[model samples]
Target: MPNTPTTYPAGLSRREVVAWRNGIFTIFALCGIGIASWMARTPAVKAALDVSTAEMGILIFAIAIGSILGLLLSSHLLARFGAIAVMSACFVVAPVGLVVAGLAVTLGQLYWVAFAGLAIFGVGMATCDVAMNLSGAVNERILGRTIMPVFHAFFSFGTMIGAGLGALAELLHVSIALQAGIVSAVMFAVGLLAVRMTQSETVLHVPDETDAAAPDGWRSRLAIWKDPRTLLIGLIVLGMAFAEGSANDWLSLAAVEGHGVDRPTGAVVFGIFVTAMTLGRLTGPRVLDRYGRVPVLRASAVLAALGLLIFIFVPVLWIAIVGVVLWGLGSALGFPTGMSAAADDPRTAAARVSAVATIGYCAFLVGPPLIGFLGEHFGLLHALLLVLVLIVVAGVASGSARDRTKTL
Candidate 1:
C-alpha cells in the first residue's frame, strides 16, 4: 500500500496569526498615540505661551530632533536588544513621553520633555518599523505572493482607531493629561503583551536558492545599493515619505488655521485620511496584481496631488474630507510598492532595499518639521499646495521605475 499523505491545517494557528496581528497593532499605535496630546492640546499649548509660528516651528523641530536621534540609534538598539525587547522598550518609553508632555507645566518644559520622549519613542518605533518591514518583505517573498499592502493596511487601521479614540476622549472633556495617560496605558498593555504573541519569521524560516538568489556575502549584498535602479526606487520612497509625514504633522493644523474648523473636527482630519488610506491599502494588491505597479502608482500620485489641491484651495470641510480620501487612496501603496520592487529587482534586491529604506526614513525625520516651518513662514493653506508638487514628483519617479525595471 502507498504511504499515507501528510496534511496541514487549513488556517493559521492562533499564535501564528497573533504575531502578525500584534506587530501591526504596535505600528498603528505609534501613529495615533502621540497625537492625542498634540491634537487635544495644540491650541492650548499655543495659547498658553502666546508663541509665534516660528517658535512653534522650533518646538515641533525639537520632537523631530528626538526622532532623528532615534533614527540614528535604532540599528544599534536593534542589534543589541533584539526586536522584542526593543519594541517593549518603545512601548514603555513612548507612553512615558506622552505622560511627561501631558503633565509639564510650562511650554519650554513641554517642548523639552516632548523632545526627549520622542527620542526614546522614535528609537523604539524606528527600529520596529525597519524590523517589521524587513520581516514582511521576506515573508512575502517566501509566500510567493504580496502581503506588504495588507500589513500596511492594518497599520493604517491602527492609526484610524487611535485617532478616533483620542478625538472621542477629548470630546468627552477628558483632560489632555488624562487623555494622554489613558492612551499610554492602552499602548503599553497592548505592546507588552504582544511580545509573547508575535514571533519573528527570520528565525523560523530560511530561504531557498530562489529566495537567496543573490550571492552570499556583505560585499554582494552591499553592491545592491550601488545600482542606479535601486537609487531611483529610493527617490520614490523619499517623495512619498515627505508627503505622508507632512500630512500626519500638519493636517489638523491646516483644518484649524486654514479652514477655521474647531479643534475636535480638525483632530479628526488624519483619522479620516488614515481610515481611507487603510481601506485603499487593504484593497490595493488586487488592483496592483491586475493593473501592474506603474498605472496604480501614477493614479495614486495624481489622486494625492488632487486631494491636497482640493484641501488647500477649497474651504468646505466635507469637500476637504473627500480630497483626503482621494489622497489616501492615491498614496496608499508608496512604501510597500517601493520596497517590494527593490527586493524583486535583480540589480539590488535586499541591500538596495536597506539603502532605500534608510534614505526614505531619513526623509520622514525631516519632512514633518519642514512642513511646520512652511506652515509657519508661509500661509498654512499655501504651504499644503507643496504636497501636490511632491506627489507629482513621486508619480514620475515610481512610474519611471516601473518602465526601467521592465526594460531590465
Candidate 2:
C-alpha cells in the first residue's frame, strides 16, 4: 500500500490554496519559457558558432551532462534547503545562464562560452524541475485532484509564447544576446511574484508518514532505484522525454535543414508543436480521470509512434504540420503522468521523482548527440526513426503507471 499523507497543514483558506496553485503554475510556465527561448534560437546559435551538426551535438551534450549532475544532486538539495528555496535560487540561475549563452555566441571562443553557459543553464533547469514537480505533487494531495497535467499545460503555453517571440525576433533580425537579455529580465521579474506567492503558503510543515518510516541518509534514496515498478515508470517517461526533447532540440533544425524551410518558418513549425501539446495537456486530465493511467498512456504511445512515422515519411509540408500536431498531442501526457505515478506515495515522492526524472533525462543526454551523428549520415528526418522504437518500448511499460490499487 502507498503511504499517503494522513493530514494537511491546518487552516489554509481556499483563496490561499488557489494562490499557491497559481504560483506553481507560473513557475512551471517560466521554466518552459526559458527553455523554449533557448531552443528556438538554437539554429541561430549554431550559425553564430559556425559549428557542424556533430559539433553542435557535442555542445548540446554538455547541457545534458550538467542536467544529469543536477538531477543526481536535487534530492539532497531539496531535503536540505526545501523546495521553495531551491526553486527560487535555480529560477535566478537558469535565466542568467541563458543570458550568458546568448552573449557567448558573440565571442571568439564561441564553443567554450556556449558550452559553459549551457552547462549552467542545464543544472539550473534540472534542479528547478524537481523542485516544481515536488511542489505540484504535494499540492495535488492537498487538493485531492489531478492537477499535475494542468501545471505542465501552463509550461506548454509558455513554450508557445517563447517560440512565437523567437520567431518574431528571427524575422526582425534581433541579436540573440539582446533577445535573451530581454527575456531574462521579464522572467526574473515574474519569477519574483511566483516565489512570493508560493512562500505565502503555510503547508510545508506537514510531513508524510512514509518519510518517517523510511530509513534516513543515502540508503533510502538509493533504494528507490531498486524498485522494479519505479524503474519501469522511468522507462515509460524516458520514451516521452525522447519524443518531446527531440522536438525541442531538433525540430526546427530538421525543418530548416531537411525540408529547406526558412528559419522563421521553422520556428513557426516548432510553435505549432508546442501549441498542440498545450491543447493536449489542457484536456488530458479529464481523459486520464475517466480512463485511468495505463490505457491513456498506451494510447498516447501508439499515437506518438504513428505521428513520428507520418512526419518522417511524408514529404508534403501541410501533411507534416498535421503530423506535428499528432506528435505533440501524443507526447504531452507521458512525462507529467509518469511524475504523478512516481509520486503516488507521498512519503518517497521526492526521491522517486528524482530517480524517474534522472532516468528520463537520459533521453536528452543521448537523443541530441545521437540524432546529430545520424543526421550527419541518414539525414535529420531519417534519424528521427529512432524515437519510434522508444515509443514501442514505452507502450509495453505503460502498465507500470496503473494505480497501485488497480494493479494490486
Candidate 3:
C-alpha cells in the first residue's frame, strides 16, 4: 500500500458511471448462477466422484483459496491497474473455471477445478463488489442519499436466477459438464458485454506516477491493525463472514444429514435459504435506514441462533423449513453490513474494508470443508452445533461494531 490520492471526481464520466453499474450486476448475475447450481447439485457431484463428506470438505477449499488470493491482492492490484481492467479480466475467467470443475473426476481434480473456478468467480465478485462500493460511496458523497442496498438487490435477484437455473438443470439431468459449459458460455458472454461499459480510465488513479512496490511491506495493511476500532471492526466482519459461510455451505447438508431429507429436497433447502436471504437484503435498507445496521445485525444474530437451534432440536422435517427461513433472514445482513462498516469512509477505507473482508470471507472458504470433515468424523448435527456457537460470536461482533461504524 501506497495510497494514490484515491478520490472519484465530483461527477464521473458518463461512460464510467454506466459501466460500473452495469458491470456490477453482470458479475452478480453470473455468480448467482454458479453458486446456485453448485449448491443444488452438491449430492450429484459428490456421488459422481464417490466423495465422502470429508473429501468433499477438502475439495471446497479450492474455492476458499481463490477467494483469499482475490481479496488480499485485489486492493493493490486495482490501485495499480484500475477497476475495469481487473474486473473485466476476472469475469472472463469465471466461466472457464466452471467448465473445468464440471469435467473434474477425482477428488483432487474437483478441488482444483472448483477452487480455480471459484477463485476466478471470487476475483470477479471481489472486483465488482469493491468497484461498486467505491462508486456507490462516491455517489452517496456527491448526492447525499443511500443507494447501496438497492443496488445490492440486483445481486439478490441474480442469486434467485442462479438457484432456479441450477434446480432446473438438475431436474433435466443435464451432465455437470454440459451445465457448466452453459454457465461458462453465459459468463463469458456477460463479461464481453460488460467490457464495453467500464471506464477505460479512472479518476482514482495518480497520473504521471510510476509506483514502486514494497518488498517486506505489510505497512499499508499494518495501519489498520494499529487502530483498535479498525481491528475490532475487522474481527466483527470476520465473525459475520464465518457465520454466513457456514450457513451457505452447510445448511443443505445439515438438512439432509440431521433431518433425513432426501438429496434433491435438501439442496432445495439451500435455495430456500438464499431466497429468504435475498428477500431480506432487498428489504433490509429500508429497515437499516429507519433504525441502523447494528440493531439489525443483533436482531439477525438472535434470529439465526434460533433457526439453528430449531434445525438441531426439532427433528421434524416439516418444521425445519421455518428454521431455515429464519436462518436465512438472520444471515442476510451480516456480510454486507460488515463490509459497509469496514469501508464507510473515503480515503483508505476501501482497502481496509477489502482487507477485513479478505480475512472474513476466508472463513467461508475454510469453514465449509472443515464442517464437512467434522461431520464426516463426528456427525453433521454436531457440526451445526459448532456453527451455532460461531453465530453467537458473530452477534457479538455486530454489537461491538455499531459504535465504530457510526464513526466511520
Candidate 4:
C-alpha cells in the first residue's frame, strides 16, 4: 500500500503510519481467515467428532467463552503492555490453538481437546481484536476519515479467500489437520510481520490530560458500563455481531442440512456471503458519511432481518444465495461503526472500546448454543427467526451510534 499524503502524528513518519495502517488491515484479514477456516470445515469436524447439532453448538461455545475472557482482559493488557505487544503475543497464541484443535480433531478425534484448543484460539483472537480495533481507531483519527469499514472489508476479503480454499480442500479430500497446520503457519508468520510494521503504543494511544485528576482504576473502567449511550451502542453491535457470528458458525450447516447442499457447495455459499460482506464494507464508508450512522445502522438492521427471513423461508438455492448476500451486506458495518462510536472520545477510547466489545461479544457467548438448541427443536432454518427480533432491537437503538463529536 502506498502512503497517502496526510499529516503525520508527532514522532511518526508518513511511511510508518502507512505501514501501521497496512499492518492493521493485515491483522484483521488474518483473523477473518482463521475463523472462516474453522467455519468452513465445521461439517467435517462435526462428523469426525460424531456430534449432533446441539452438541456441536456446545463445542462452538468454547470459543465464545475464550473470547469473553479475552475482551474482559483486553483493556488491562493494553494499559499494561500496549497494543503492539498484546497483538504480537496473541498472534502467536492463536495459531498454536488452531494447530492444537486440528491435531485433536484429525489425530485423536478428541472432543475435549478440540474444545480446549478452540477456547485458546478464542482468547487470543478476541484480545487481539480489541487491540487492533483500538489501533485502527487511532489510524482513523490520523487519516481523518471513516476507514474502519475498509479495515473490516479486508477481513471479509480474507474470509472469502479462506472459504474458497476450504471448499477446494473439501473437494480434494484434504485432511482438516493438514489444512489447519499450513494455514496456522502462514497466519503466525503474517501476524508477526504485521505486528512489526505497526506503530508503537505511544503513537497509537494519546492520553487525555483533562482526565488526569479523575480516579484511575477498575472502578473508572467499570463506570463506562453505566453510560446509556455505550450500552445502546453495545446493543447495536450485539445484534449485528450475532447476525454475523451466526453465519460464521452455522451458515454452511444451514446450507447443507437445511437447504440440502453438499459440503463443498455449502462452503461456496459461505464464500458468496463473505464476498457480499466485502463489497458492503468496501462501499460502506461513503454511505455512512452521507447518511450518518443512525440511519445507516437502522437501514442495515432492516436489510439483515429481511435477508434472514428470506433465507429461512425461501428454499430455492439461488434465492437463498441472494438472501445470503443481503445478510452479508447488512452485517458488514455494525461492528466497525460501533467501535468508532465507542471511541468518539479519545480520552476514554480504550476503556469504552473494551466495555462495548465485551457487551457486544456477549452475543457470541450466547448466540451459538441458543441458536443450536433452537435449531435442534425447531429446525435450523426456522430457528434463525430469533435473529430478527434482535435485529429489530438494534434498529431501535441505532440512534446511539450517532457520532457525538461531529454533527454528521
Candidate 5:
C-alpha cells in the first residue's frame, strides 16, 4: 500500500513552500558545481602532481571509498538529526575538503594529500546527496506531485556552468588552487543562503509502525537490506548510474580514439550529450506526470540502448551526434526517477534512498576500470557495448518505479 500523505506544520503559506523548494533546488545545484569544479581542474592537478594515469586512478578511487562510507552512515544520521541538519553540516565539510585538496598540490606528499582530500570531499558529497534528496522527497509529498526531475535539472545546469568556468579559468592559466578556492567560496555563500531559506520550513515525518518496533543501528539497516523492494530499487539505480557514468568518463575519449575525431570536436560531441540531458531533465517532470514512471523509464532505457548502439556502430560524426542526443535524453530520467521510487514510502525513504545511492555509487567505483579493461582489447567504442546490457537490465526493472498507489 502507498504510505499515507504527510501533513506539513500548520500555516505554511504557498509562498513559503515555494521558497523552501527553491532553496533545496539551489543546494542541489551547488552540489553539482562543487564536484564539477574539482573534475574540471583534474588535468591541472594531474600536471601539478606529475602522477601517472594508474596513480591518478588510485586517487580517484579514494573518493568512491569515502562516498560509500558516507552512504553507509547517512541513514542513521538522518534518523537522528534530520536531513536539514545533516545537509548543513555537509555544506561546511564539502568546501573544507575542496580547499584541502587545493592545498594538497603544494604538499610534499602530493598523492597522499590529494587522496585524503578527495576522500573527505566524497564523504561530504555522499552525505549531502542523501540529505538533499530526502528533503526534496519530503517536499514532493507535501506538494503532492513530481518535482524531483526539475531539481535534478538545476544540478545539470550547475555542472554546465562549472565546466564552462573551469574551461575559461584553464584558458587563462589559472592555478588549480585558485580555481578550487573561488568555487568553494562561492558555494559556501550559496549554502548559507540555502540554510536560511530552509530553516523555517517544517519537515514532514511520516509515521511508520514498523520503525517504532525496530531496533536502532545496524539492525535497522540490515532490515532495510533484506527488503526485496529496496534491493530491486538499488538494482534499478545501479543500471542508470552505469549508463550515465560511462558516458561521463568515456564519451569524449571514445569519440576521439574510436571515431577518429579531433580532441576539440570530440569535446563538442560531449557538449551535445550534456545539453540533451539537461533539456530532458528540465522537461521530465511533466512527462512523468502524464505517462507515469514505468512506461517512461522503460522507453528511456530502450532509447538509451539504441543510442549507444548507433554511436558505436555508426562511425560518422553526424550520426554519432544524433546518437549522443538520444543517449543523453534516455539517460536523464532514470537516476532521478529511481530516487523517487526509493522514496515512495516516506516512512522508509531515508534508509531506502541510502541503499539505492550506495548501489549507484558502486557503478562509479566499478564502471571506469571495467570499461578501461575492456577497451584494452576491444577499443573504447566497442567496450561501451557493455552499457547496452545494463540498459536492458534497467528496462526490465522499470516496473519497480510504478507509483505506489498503483499495482505493479
Candidate 6:
C-alpha cells in the first residue's frame, strides 16, 4: 500500500499530492539518467576526443560553470515563475544539451563543441535540481514523514538502469551519439509528463515591510548564506556531494585505469556502486525515522571513509568491490538530509535550499579538476584518498543536520 499523509497541501487532493510526489520522483530519475548517460561513456568520450585525464577534467569543468549559473538563478526563477514552469523549461533544455554533446563527440569530434553542450546541460540540470528538491521538501511536510531519501533512491535506480544500458551499448559497439539520442529522447518525453503532474503550491518565503529585502528579491535570497545552521548543513552536503560526484565522474575510469579492468567491466563496477546507493537510499527513510539524522549521518560518514580507505589500499579486486559498496551506502544520505535540514522552516525553504545546494555544488565545481590534477601526480586510486578526508569532516559536522522541526 502507498503511504499517504493525513494532511494535503491547500487546493490539492490526495490523488494530486500523490501524483506530485511521483512527478518529483520522475524528475530526479531523469536527472540521474542524464548524468549517468554521459558519465558511463566517459572513457569512450576521452578516446573520441583524444584527451588525457587532466584535460578531461577541464572539459568536465564546463558543466560546473553552467551548474553554478543555474543554481544562482533557481530561487529567483521559482519565485517568479513557480516550480512547474521552471522545471518544464529545464527538462527541455537538458535533453537538447545532451543530444548536442552526443553528436559533437561522435560525429564532429570537437572538444569545444562537446564542452559547450555539457555546459548547457549543466544549466538545465542544476536549476531543475533545486526546483525538484524544493517541491519534494514541500511534499515531505504534507506527507508528515521522511520520504526524501526515496526520491533520491529513484535517482540511484535510474543510474543503475543507465549503467546497465551503457554497459550493454559498450559491449555491442553502439556509438555514444546514438545511445545519447535514444536516452535523451526518452528523458524529454517522460519529463514533460512528469512536469505536468507536479503541484504549483508556493513555498516562497514571505517577508515583512520592515525586512531589508523583498521576499522574492535577490537580497533576500543571498541573505540565506548568513545563517550558520544552513551553512553547517551545506558543509555536510559539500563533503558527501564530493564523495558521490567524484564517483560519478571518475569511478569507471578509476576501475579501468587503476584496477586494470576492461571498459565493459569498468562500467559494470560503476553499476555495482549505483546498485549499492539505490539499496541504501531505499532503506534510508526507515533508519532515519528510527535513529534520527545526526547519528545516521555520522554512521554514513564512517562507512564512506572506511570504503574509500579500503578501495585505495586494497590490492585485491573483490575487496575493493566491497569498498565500493560501502562508499555508495555512505554517500547516499548527506545531500538529501541536508536539503531536508535546510528546509526545516517552510517559509524559508526556497532560499535556504537554493543556498545549501549552491554550497554543495561547489564541490562538484572544484572536485573534477582537483582530482584530475592530483591523479596526474599520484595515481587515480591514491588521489581518491582526498574523498576520505572530506568524509571525516562531514562526520564531525553531522550534528548540525539534526532535525529542528520535530524530533524523530
TM-score of each: 0.72, 0.84, 0.77, 0.86, 0.93, 0.87
> Candidate 6 clash total?
0
Query: Model 6: per-residue lDDT, tens digit, 233-328?
Result: 999999999999899779999988998889998888887887888788888888888888999999999999999888888878999999999999
Better of 3 and 5 by lDDT: 5
Query: TM-score winner among the candidates?
Result: 5
Candidate 2, which segments miss by more than 4 Å at Cα?
Answer: 1-9, 43-56, 106-111, 168-175, 199-216, 250-271, 312-322, 375-382, 405-408
Worst 10 residues of 6 by lDDT: 203-212
TM for candidate 2 is 0.84
Which of 1 and 3 is ahead in lDDT? 3
Q: Considering only N, C-alpha and C atoms within 3 Å, which residue pairs clash in candidate 2?
A: none
User: What's the ranking of the predictions by TM-score, best on top?
Assistant: 5, 6, 4, 2, 3, 1
CA lDDT, every prediction? 0.65, 0.83, 0.66, 0.86, 0.83, 0.86
Query: Which residue pairs come into collision in candidate 6?
Result: none
The C-alpha RMSD of each candidate to the native structure, in angstroms, is 6.3, 4.2, 5.8, 3.7, 3.0, 3.4
lDDT of 2 by residue, 108-207 (tens): 6478887888898889989989888888877765665677899999987787778778888899999899888998887788886896677421254435
> For residues 108-129, what per-residue lDDT tens digits would candidate 1 score against the true structure?
5465565455455555555556
Model 5 residue 319 CA deviation (Å) reads 1.8
Q: How many residue pairs of model 2 clash at the backbone?
A: 0
Clashing pairs in 1: 300-330
TM-score of 3: 0.77
List runs of model 1 lying over 4 Å from the truth: 1-22, 25-27, 34-39, 44-56, 76-82, 103-114, 168-180, 201-230, 249-272, 306-324, 342-354, 362-365, 368-382, 399-408
User: How much does candidate 5 score in TM-score?
Assistant: 0.93
lDDT of 3: 0.66
